[model samples]
Target: MSTRQYGTFVVIGSGSGIGNHVAYTFAVKGFSHIIPLARNDWTYNRVCFFNAARIVLGGLLESVETIEENFETTNIALYIVAQWAIPRLRALSASSAAAKSSLLVTNSLLYANPIPQLFSLSLVKAAQCSLVMSLAKTFNSSGIHIALVTVGGAVAPEKLESKKYC
Candidate 1:
C-alpha cells in the first residue's frame, strides 16, 4: 500500500484497544504529529517503529498557551480521536481552511441494527449517524473529508469486567 504525506492528527479514545492501535499506526509513520488522547491510561504499541516516537497526551485545552506549548498551536492540523467526537472534531477542524483535517472513524455495525443487549448504544448510534450526515452536508466546502467505517467483532476489548462479553 502507498502512504500519503500529511501533518499531525489527534487520536481520541486511544488507550488499549482499536483506538490505541490506530494512534500507534499514525505514530509509526505517515505523520510527524501523533496526539494520543485517551480517557483511559492504557497504551499499546503494535509496532516497533513507534518505540521511540513522541506521543502527546492531553484531554482538552484549558488555555491557548496550553495547547501551544504541548501541541505547538501554531500548526492547527488535527483529527477527532473518538468515534462519537469524530464529526464534531471534523467540523471544528474544518471550520477554518488552515485546520486541514480529515476524519476516519470506526463505528459499530449495530449502529444500523437494533440489539436488545446494546439498546442504549443503538440510540447513541442513531444520534451519531444523524450528526454525521449533518456535518458532512455543512462542512464539505471547508475541504474536510468524512470517512465512515462501520465495523464490529474485529478487535475485541482486552480488559473486561466479565469474560462473558468476550
Candidate 2:
C-alpha cells in the first residue's frame, strides 16, 4: 500500500542510506517527481567543499562532517542548495495537482532518543525539525504539508541511488 494517499515528493540526499529510504517510501506510495541528490567518492570529495573548508579552518571545528559519511548534504551548502533547490521544488509542486504534497526528512532517533555519541546528529536533525516546522507554518495555509520523520536508527539499503555524470 502507499504511505501517502497521493502527492508529489522531491527528496534530496538520496544517493544511498536514509535519504534513499525516504525516496523509495514515497515511490512505493506512487508519488511522482522523485529527485535524488546523489554523490560518490570522486564527486563527493572534489565537488563537495565541506572538507576543504575544514582544512582551511585547520580542523578546529570538531563537528565538521565527512561528505561520504554524512547525510546532511543540506549542511555543507544550506544557503545555496535550500535557496535554489527548495524554491524550485516548491514551485513545481505548486504547479501540480497532487494531493498532500510535502517534504520528508530522514533524521535519526539517536538524536531524539538521547545519546552522546549521536549528539551531533541530533543537533543536525533538530535543525532539520525546526526547518520543517518553519516551512509548515509558512506553507500550510498555502496547502503544503511538511513532515520531519525520525527513522529510529540507521537501516540497510537505500531507497534511491546517486547518478554520476561522466
Candidate 3:
C-alpha cells in the first residue's frame, strides 16, 4: 500500500530489538512517515500508527528500582501514549473511510508463564496485557483497533545470514 493509504507510522521504543525491527519493517513496507522515538520520547506532533513495544530486562533479585523501571517502560508508557493516540485515531477513523487507525503493543507470553529470573518483566507484561485488553474492549467498536502482539520468547534482531530453507 502507498503512504497515502497508511498515513504516518509512529513506533515508540524503536531504539533496538523488536521495536527497531518493527520500524524497519514498516519502512520497507512503504509506510512513508515512520517516527522512531526512544522510550522517554513519546511526544509526537502527528497522530497515526502507534507501536508501543518497550522492554527492560529485570530479575526477581533486583532492587525495587528495577521493578519500577520495568513498569514505567512497559505499562505506564503504553498507557500514556494510548491516552494521547486513541482520540486522534478515532478522529482519523471518522474522517476517512479507508483509514484504519490502530494502536499495536508488543507483548510477551512470559506474563502467563512467569520465570523467577525475570519476575519483574513478567509482572509488568501482565499489567500491560490487561491494559491492552481493556483498551480493545472499550475502543474496538469505535474504530480504534487496539491489539497486543505477544512474543513467546526472547526477542533479538534477526540475522540475515541465519536464514534457513525448510
Candidate 4:
C-alpha cells in the first residue's frame, strides 16, 4: 500500500492487542499524527480504527452487570467514537481529493459462530457488526470508507511453520 504522510491516524484500545499493532503499522506507514487511545480514553480523528473490546467469560451464567459492562466497553464505545470521527472524516474527504478517510472497526467471528461460554461478547460483536455495516452504507457514497476487520481467532505471532503458507 502507498503511504500517505499527511493524515491523522487514531487507534482506540491501542494499549494492547490488534489496536497496538495497527497503531504501530500506521506510524511506520508515515501517518503524520498517530493518536493512541487506551480502552478508557475518549480522545478522538482520521482513519479512525476501533478495536476496544472486552472478553466476558461467563456465558449465560454471567451477571447482568458484567454483560452490561461488556457492551459499554465494546459496542457503546465504538458508537461514541464513530459519532465523533465520521463527520470529520466526511469533511476531510470532501475538502481534498487526495484525502483518504476511513473508519475501521475490529470484529470477531463470535458474531457468526456464537460461543456459549462468551455469550455477552458474542452479543456485543453482533451488535458491532450491524453498526459497522450501517455506517458503511451511510458513508461510503460520500467517500468515507467504513469497514469491519473480523478476526476469526486470537491474534498472535505466527509460528515458524506458518511462514511456508506465505
Candidate 5:
C-alpha cells in the first residue's frame, strides 16, 4: 500500500524547469490545491560575450552587482507571496483535520557548494534554505510542513523541452 499526500501546496519559482516539473508532479499525484507562483521574466542581452571568452571574463566582476540586484528582486517577490499565502494555507489546514499544508521551495545544490560564475544564485538558494529551515521549526506544531528541495547536476535537454507540455 502507498501513502497519499494531502492538503494544499504553495510552490514558489514555478516559472520553468524544476519548478514547473515539481508543480505538475504534485498535481498528477492527486494534489487538488496547487498554488504555483512564478516570477516575472528578467531579460538581458548577451552582448558581453559574442563568441569570445576574454570579453566575457573581463566583465565577470561587474556581473556580481547585477546578480545581486536580481537576487533582491526575486527575494522580495517571494516574501510577498509567502506573506499573502500563509493565511490561506492556515485556513485550509484548519478546515480539515487530515489536511496538511506545505510550502515547497525549489533550490539548487549550488547552495552548498557555490559555483564561481553563479555566486549570486548560490547565495539566494542558501538564504532560501535557511528560511525554510526556520519556518519548519516555527510551524512544526501547526501542521504545516515547510520543505526545501535542492536539485543538482545537469538537467537533461529532453526534460527542458518537455517543460513546455507540463
Candidate 6:
C-alpha cells in the first residue's frame, strides 16, 4: 500500500526515536508534506534520583528549577504541537475527503511497564496515550486519524554511549 494513502502527517517527537523512523519511512514512501515537530534539546536530559537527591542535599534550587522546566517542556510541548497540527490535518482532510491526515505519536513501552526510577516518564507516556485516544474519539468523523506507535526494547543508537538501566 502507498503511504500517500494518508496524504500527510504531523509527527511530533520526530527529532529522534520511533518518530524519526516513521517520518523517514513516510518520506521514502512519497509523503512530501510531513511536518516534524522540533523540540529543544534540553528536554532530552531526564532527571534521575541521583541528580535530584544531590540537588536537594546541596540546596541547588536552580538545578531543581531547571529540571522542572525541562520536564514541563517535554510533557507539554507535544500537546502544543498537536494542537497546532490538528487544524492543518483537518484542513488536509477537507481538501481530500477520502484521505485522512494523521497525528502519529511515538509512545514507549514504559507507559505500561513502569520503571520505578523513571516514574515521571511513565506518567507522561500514560497521559500521552490518553490524549491520543481522546483525539481519536473526538475527530474520528472529521477524517483525522490518531495513531500510536509504542516502541519496546529499542536500544540506543550505535554512536551513543549505552548506560544500563539497572
lDDT of 1 by residue, 56-118 (tens): 333332344443442321112222233344555455554554454555433456457756554
TM-score computed on alpha carbons, candidate 1 = 0.38
List the global CA lDDT of all models: 0.46, 0.48, 0.71, 0.79, 0.57, 0.58
Ranking by TM-score: 4, 3, 5, 6, 2, 1
Q: Measured by TM-score, how close is model 3 to the native structure?
A: 0.65
Higher-TM-score candidate of 5 and 6: 5
**Using lDDT as the measure, which candidate wins?**
4
Q: Per-residue CA lDDT of candidate 2, range 1-166, in tens?
A: 3434666676655555777677666765567556655554311211111110111111223345442234354444443544554554566456645433445554555445645555454555556556657766876566445555556654534332343222
Worst 10 residues of 4 by lDDT: 157-166
If scored against the real structure, what TM-score would every candidate get? 0.38, 0.45, 0.65, 0.69, 0.57, 0.53
Tens digits of lDDT, candidate 5, 59-159: 32556666666456545555665676566666666766756576666666866887667656666667766766776688656766667656687445345
Q: Which pairs clash in model 1?
A: 12-81
Q: Which model is ahead, 3 or 6, in terms of lDDT?
A: 3
Ranking by lDDT: 4, 3, 6, 5, 2, 1
Which portions of model 2 show Cα errors greater than 4 Å? 1-80, 93-100, 158-166
Give me the displacement of residue 42 in model 5, in angstroms: 35
Candidate scoring better on lDDT of 1 and 5: 5
Flag clash pairs in model 3: none
Q: How far off is residue 54 in model 4, in Å?
A: 0.5
Model 5, 16: alpha-carbon shift in Å? Answer: 22
Error of 4 at 155 (Å): 2.0
lDDT by residue (1-166, candidate 6, tens digit) is 2425556777887666777677656755566567777575523222110001111122223344544544465446766767787787777677653544777776777668966555555555677778778877987578777777676854344423232221
> Candidate 5 — worst ten consecutive residues by lDDT sum?
44-53
